[model samples]
Target: MRYLSLSLVVVVLVATIGLGWVFDFVYQQYSDPKQSPSEDKIEYAEILTKKMAVALSSSNNANAFITAWQANDGYSLQIDSINSLALPAPLLSDLRLGKSLNIESDSDLNIHYAIPNSSDVLILQIPYTIEDNKKFINRYWVTSLFYLLLIVLFLLWAKPLISRLINLRETAKAFGKGELSQRITVGKVSYISDLESEFNHMAQRIEDLVSDVKLLSTAVSHDLRTPLARIRMGLDTLSEEEEPAQRRVYEKRINAHIDDMVELVETLLAYARLDQSMLAIEKTSIDLFALTEKIIKNKQKERPAEHDKSILLEADASLAHCFAVGDNTYLKMLVNNLLLNAIQHSKTTVLVKICCRPNSLVLVVEDDGDGIPEDIKVDLFKPFVRSKANKNKGHGVGLAICKRIVQWHQGSITVEKSEQLKGAKFIVNLPSVEN
Candidate 1:
């Protein structure tokens, strides 16, 4: 912290000094006494020059005016032949035309005018030596000192800020070194308070995701063992059975085991893919209402074969074109998962509704079956979470995949009691494209 503060202070001091020099140079250029003196000083000089010219024009008072001009107000008077003055031709022309002149030197000023109807030139001199500007130079030194002191104070005040940033960096390093619990505790008083808070949030998410992955690994191992053991038993039984009917029974049991394993593996793979950092996805404009209707129609055709019962799958699209921004494949997965869940649980009817709002599209899938239990509804989207009410004994990863897909598309989903169908309702909201 000390090194950083010193470095920053030195850089600031150098910059401040350079800027001060530049500003002084510009001021001197623009306010040069020879080119553009202050209005009051110019006016006073002009008045004095005119008074001297009038005095020199009168022969009777010329000698007295010369003596008065030399002794009063540090002015010197000189009268000489025009040729001896050695002035510029342009200046001589101006003087001959009755124009007065004021010329500035390093530390003095000379005012000149030609005496009317004479060959002589009258000159008045005012003293302003180098010593006269000492006060201004000293004031400049004081200003530079003042800025240097201010810069030092600012650096000292930032000491706590540097310490806080160092603490944040060390905490992040600890986190990177496998200490997942490390977190920053700085509050609103610090400079990077918002950044620290966001870091805490990100750390918490990472911890939770790690815990979930561990849980998913354990669950998969436990769940897969049962099916594999069953399949092994079926193989042994089929090898022993001689009757055709019994052999067929074993074959069917083994096939069921294989099917269950395949389903579980697919679900686990889908969940794992979502956790990956680089899941390539392309978003485009989709007619959400049309997509929902098409999915419902396809599900209706397969409903009887899967459920062994006739279920009415109805789609009510509120708009002709409910356009949204999303990847087509993820949207299909989101809708298919929700619709399949509803279809499997519905008693007689499943309803799908699509609507368009100001900046988003809303999709709702509801089933007229028993609603979800309050206890499990909160964690319905968590991996390996299944309610006791779901008799089908699903792996409980489908809704988790749906939740991830929704999040990937920058959308949201929630489960609630269906007010219209008196059952479990799933609502999905997606960003809509402008018409």
Candidate 2:
């Protein structure tokens, strides 16, 4: 904060100093009596000198000539010599240069006028009256006051911005020390508000990535232990069994455990990779209704006929022609995972519904089963999080992968208790084709 304030002060000071120099230079060149006559002064002096020379051509009285000149002018004049006046070197140089008029100043400015080849020079003493002094002081004082006001206004404008930057620096320090949740709040009128917003977004992404990595570590340790232990136990059983049939059974059990571990590892890898830069997403226009219908058909075929009677997969007619922007393959995977999740826990039926609004399409997958527990619903989208009811069914990366895919599509997915279906409702919103 202090550094910013000091920098602003320095800038204001430099600006004021530079402007002051410019104003002083202009005044000295055009308005100061000590300098050469301006254009107006030159014309006035030439006209006056011509009249005086003509008047003196027929008269020899210097006093009468000086009186006549003084009668029409505002200044006092006298005929003096070049050597007696102790004129400055510059005026003496001007006299030697054969110039028509010579000007010189000491404590006060004066003009020396002499006709060519005349030994006596006419001296006009320019006065410094109280009014002139007042005007000079007022001009400089007003200019200084104006510059001071500008500096004050600049400081006022910079104060809030500097304070915000200082706060942001402290927040960054805290974030570096592991306060991943630290974020800057943006004010509407802030000069760096856009920068602050981008920083907040970057910070949030970093926080989420760090959290996902930690959760993946913990989940791998906890979920893999059971399947690995079972695989070991199954191998031990096969080693002890002499009967071929029992050995075959133990071998199959071991293979199933191996498959579970493999599937878990693959799912975790996919969920982790979904956030990476290398993941290619080819977005095209995908009909939401047709996609939902296709997923329902595939899931129905995968379900056994006996279970079909209890768990019916139905796609609402509203899902028929609604279109959205998404990668078709990833969209299918998203729908499949969501529908499978619904079917696995549903009691009698699972419903896939797609509704189209003006700008967006909503995909809903819900079932008539026990609703999600209130405690776990909030974290359902997080990696390795699952409802207590279906904890043993699969690795918890399915919904997390769905969430990552949804985010990639520039959309959002949320879970809530389905009021109509009386089950866990998953609502996914995607940009409509017309959007």
Candidate 3:
């Protein structure tokens, strides 16, 4: 629409300006006063001056001049007051001195002479009898054609844009009425192609979010049943148990179920918070190398001795302060989740590598354990997607949350088979910044 409007404006300016140029050229050629008096006009001035002198010889005024040439058709004459003429003072002086004057006329092809008859000025004019043989374009016809063409062209330009806008409005209405799949078909060079593309993207994002919410609700309802069943069973057994220790055992089991439910609810709330706050990320410069190293060391120290695994970190010496632009809090969460996930599944060593590219920093984490199986790999990053290895062990939202955090920072996270560690390798790439 913007492009079309600009084109219309340019057309208006060019057409009007071009027409003005043509109009001015024609007027200058056929209408402006001629610059030079012709030789015929000089000869007529001489003849008419003498003729007027003889005609007005008696009365030396206009009444004698009028009576002498009233029926004359060889030329035309008119009397005018000296004060009414715009002739210069010198020209008037010459006229009074009995001299005839020749001058140009406003019509490019006409010339006339002025003669003083006594105290009066007699204007001698020969009618211009040249008729135009060819039909010439006048302003009325040209202006009508300009308006007609402009209207037709404007309608042509408006039709496509109006149709697109109508389609857009209807699609928006459908989407507003809960048609989650509604989307506009994009055109190659539409005036509002960018707007269409953005709308499509927004629709897709909204659909995905709605679908995730439904899935989350279903998963929550189904997942809570097991713990609730266990809690119920524990309570029933506690009422039947006679010994204090047996009663205490049942209490412990019931408390554990309640704790699991609390944890699940807390995880869902946290995810909700993260989703809502995505656009409000508090951006700051962060030293990714240092941040990742600190997370790795802290998790390594926090792990129990019995489930020990050698956690390793590797990077070039120059990457001690590799900088990136992002919210530090979420970046820490992303790094922590990846590391915890690595430690949970690793059979031996959990290896991490940090490297810098021309415009980004890459962090790779690989675990020396069974890699992601082929069956569950497709939706491994979606919320609550559990692998057989970790089935019923933990809610499968860690990877999904990590993925969201990376995406919120305008980065990417991917997992593949590890060549070096013979397990899952997670790669995260974030835009780098100078320190």
Candidate 4:
């Protein structure tokens, strides 16, 4: 953007100056007729000679007028006998016919003019100097050369801009024609670098959305089949039964299958909502230790009697107020999902720890069960991805939701093997905010 603005300034300045100069140049020729310095000087000499002739015509004032002018005017005036000097035939004939004669010398000492006065000549002398001495800077061909230089400079600047625009146009055309992976490449000093960056970012987002849609379509088709078949089986059985108690039992079984399908649809919708919620999340400072304590107690109360695993939160009392700036509802959901995932996978205990790092607050959830299998651990946060052992259980979007929540908060989450518990450990670092 800065480069674009600076180019605009240069273009405006050059155009304004060039246009003004051209207008003034054209106007000068039409508005005023110019004369050469030599013509003007000859005209002045003619007037002077005529005035002196009139003054010398009067015998009473002739000597006084000539004497006064010789002392004041910067000219050499003398009366010479015309018969004593040998003169050219053409000049002498013109002089005898009452014409004035201007004599130019090759050495450029003086301009001498003669006028015939009876048997003598009136001579007037002045310096032979040229006055129309102009510098060759803004004249004809130099001006053309200046404008040509401007054209060359502008082309040098515009070449890169035009090339970048062409690249952007072609990349956009390719993307429009279903090339979702296509992106524009530009240099750091590019005129439209920001525009290229925005295009790349938007392209990446659309590509991810399309990929998620395809994954959801495949998952819905594959996952809904078993519940739908069970529902069909229960409906067939209910239709065959005659007794009221037996009919109620089959009806309840069918209702259970319907409920499972409903849950599946809702969980998928929730996963979709997480993507959109990024734009509307309301942020506030949250104390992670306090929030996690409530989530652990609630999960403990909600766990079934047949499950004996314990949920424990371990954090230093001094660092209990680990404030992180993010949406309260989503942060709570992030903790709940991680804790729930651990509780479900562990055999004896699920441990959650909140600790402080140099620049962020860390939240860790670990389970004391068999560590995550290497095959599924890589893509564990992806939606609809489930391990071999839990393939028939949940919807498999819980950890995916957790990952999205952490991302929206500008935090990071990673899964590893727990050194302390020898089980799967989920580590999340949320950036801390000042009070």
Candidate 5:
């Protein structure tokens, strides 16, 4: 494409130079003669005037003046010695007022002379008229047509190649964003064939690595969970009366450890399934406002009596009618995780707000509690990441799962300080179905 554009530029430069030369040549041909008035036709006119002056001085006869003018091809002249010429008003006035002595015809073909010796004046006209050079004009037009054809041909030739390159770039970008299944299609351009082949090999390798990692994670979780479950069962079989408090303590510790293991396994499984290619997404247009209301109501039912009144749900009615393109189950999971996290950490009030924007559906959950610690905020989305400040809370898989789910939906999740309340705010931005 660069070479083609350069070639086009060169062609345009050559055409411009050629056209300029042709126009210069035409201008030179039509320009006034370089010879002075005394050397060219003007000198001839002066000689004829002298002859007419001598003829009139010797014989006072107008016939000799006419004969002298005719011998010099003066018949084509508009201004002649026998009659006073009707000059343009300005020129005639200038001449009568003694400001100038020459007059030119309207076409600049003739030079009229005032002899000051005879009533008959002398007029000298050149027989030159500008004619259009068809050959030169045709050459210019042909060159222009050739330049236009070259541009059209370049576009026709490069369109597919350019599109293929762009598609390859987009596929690489998508793969970088975790779309491991994407592959570049073959194109006619042989220049990037090696690149395409390498890219395909890399994508295949990535897919294999991801598959192996997932299989390994699944295997590890299954193997570890079985032994962990056996440990729990063995602990449960311990007698309660054999140091009852100590046995109860031992059982609680074992149960807590088992719970942590189970949470870790669940988190791993969720992360592994975050790949959209692995997921069977059944996208449907869901009314998000009603869905959110339903989630809040369910949460209210599940929470303690005092907490039910503390949950504040505020949604724009107009925005409540909005829809989103997503797997309903995944959407529900996302909402539930965010709300549960907020409710668990909230001190007094938990606020849920749903609003619709031009490009996205916005769900914000804010809690009036100690916000996430500033130090651990950066690693909050990573699996099993728990801040020392909130370490006693449930295992830190909820936020990671939330991140994975939002990413799979091509949406975003961000944590910040709430504007309306002094607490942590979790904002979920899902792409609008209407958009």
Candidate 6:
């Protein structure tokens, strides 16, 4: 059964149980002898018997006995019962002895009659127990069963509505998880018509955003590459005898422009690949400290002076055996960017520390140079963002790319003040595979 059907069944069962309790209460009340008129009738018969006996003993006539009996308190003489002469024996005995009796009547008719040599009248109240219980069944159970069946039928007929609701929920979940093509298709069910409309609108908006990003990336890559290619061609065509100072200036300018173009293209590509569906990660256990050492050695070869004077690798030798689950290529790229950024900013000493914490591997790179300004630190990881202090050094894609790479690895990177050194510290925390 569907959820709605189950809910309705529960409601019906509860109502049925409630009705049963109410019937039980009413049955108990109706069955009580004190609430019936039989007890009153028996008491009245007994009083009439005492009055009649006194009148007869006084040597009065039958008419005088009847008058005395009629004069008793709370006693009414009915013509139908007296004429019928159908009084029960038990009631007659009570009337003659001036004692109380209890009786029950089932039918509408009752019997009242006088005894021999006495004006006392007996009242016969027939048993009505079976009829009373029958009334309860007819009055309550029949109507209750009818409504319960109707509720069950309604719930069964609503199966299509419940199914549509379940489909809509699943579609919403898929769309939320980056499936832009997911749509809710509920045919002819007007109840969920509004939700279906809203879902379509949301899906359309998501598709539009994805399309726009793809188009923008393609156009920007094509448009920007043409100028960079032309600049490189012009530099290649420069004459050998050109003024040395002017040629050097031109070379620097051309190289700077090319660097700028490359940085812009890389940043755009990284941003476009932020969604997990766009990239596949092949994870393997890699020694994190060894990876860091390899990246540091490679950077030393690329920028020998910067590495020799400034960079320092302080890692526990034991941590060299520690491993993490990540794509090694992306992990290398992430470490390279952070180390390069530190080398560019650090003045004298750049410390790279790797250690293992419970459930996580921590890498801290601190530079003993002027730290980043507080105002610009918040925007450090944003694409195409740069600080005035480092504008001449290189493009600011390094940190943004680092951030994306760390996120792809299911890790985190943050900047803070280094306690042991007077500079900025970049901390990278990755899940520890060893544990």
Q: Which of the two candidates, 3 or 5, achieves a greater lDDT against the reference?
A: 3
Can you tell me which runs of candidate 1 are displaced by over 4 Å? 1-138, 141-209, 236-244, 275-278, 305-322
RMSD of each: 10.0, 7.3, 7.6, 12.6, 17.2, 15.1
Better of 2 and 3 by TM-score: 2
Instruction: Please identify model 2 stretches exceeding 4 Å from their true place.
Output: 1-46, 49-107, 110-114, 117-123, 278-287, 301-330, 357-359, 408-410, 431-435
Cα lDDT of model 2 by residue, 1-435, tens digit: 344456667767766776677777866675657643344655675556545644554566967768776764467767666667676787776754544454545434465655445665556655555555666686778688768766776777679888988988998999999999999988866667767877887788788889899999999998899999998888888889999998988988899999889999998887777777325888888987767776666666777652653434344454455578988888988998898788777778787777776677888888887888777777888888876667447877778878878877879999888898798889999987752
| Clash count per candidate | 0, 1, 0, 0, 2, 5
Candidate number with greatest lDDT: 1
Q: Model 1, 354-406: lDDT tens per residue?
A: 77887888888888889888878878888888877678758987788788778
- How would you encode candidate 4's per-residue C-alpha lDDT over 16-61 as one tens digit per residue? 5865576567656643255444578677876787566545655565
- Per-candidate Cα lDDT values, in order, are 0.78, 0.74, 0.77, 0.77, 0.68, 0.67
| Residue-wise C-alpha lDDT for candidate 6, range 1-435, written one tens digit per residue | 244456567656665676657666776675555554545744665565445444444564655444555654434332223234455776556545655344334443233344445454444333345555676566576667657765775576567677888888898898889888998774763456666777886686477456646655664776577658867675875555388887887787778778767766775676566544327878888887788888887888888656455677887655755787788888888788888888887778889999887777888999987887887788677554566666555545678777767776768999988777788899999987663
lDDT of 5 by residue, 150-171 (tens): 5676576567657768888999
Residue 220 of model 5: what lDDT?
63
Work out the TM-score per prediction.
Answer: 0.60, 0.73, 0.69, 0.63, 0.50, 0.47
Cα misplacement distance, residue 165 of candidate 1 (Å): 5.7
In candidate 6 the C-alpha lDDT for residue 23 amounts to 63
Q: Model 4, stretches more than 4 Å misplaced?
A: 1-134, 138-171, 183-198, 304-307, 315-322, 357-359
What does candidate 5 score on TM? 0.50
Those runs of model 6 whose alpha carbons end farther than 4 Å from true positions after fitting are: 1-263, 270-278, 316-322
Ranking by TM-score: 2, 3, 4, 1, 5, 6
Error of 5 at 410 (Å): 2.9
Query: Clash number for model 5?
Result: 2
Worst 10 residues of 1 by lDDT: 307-316
C-alpha root-mean-square deviation, candidate 6: 15.1
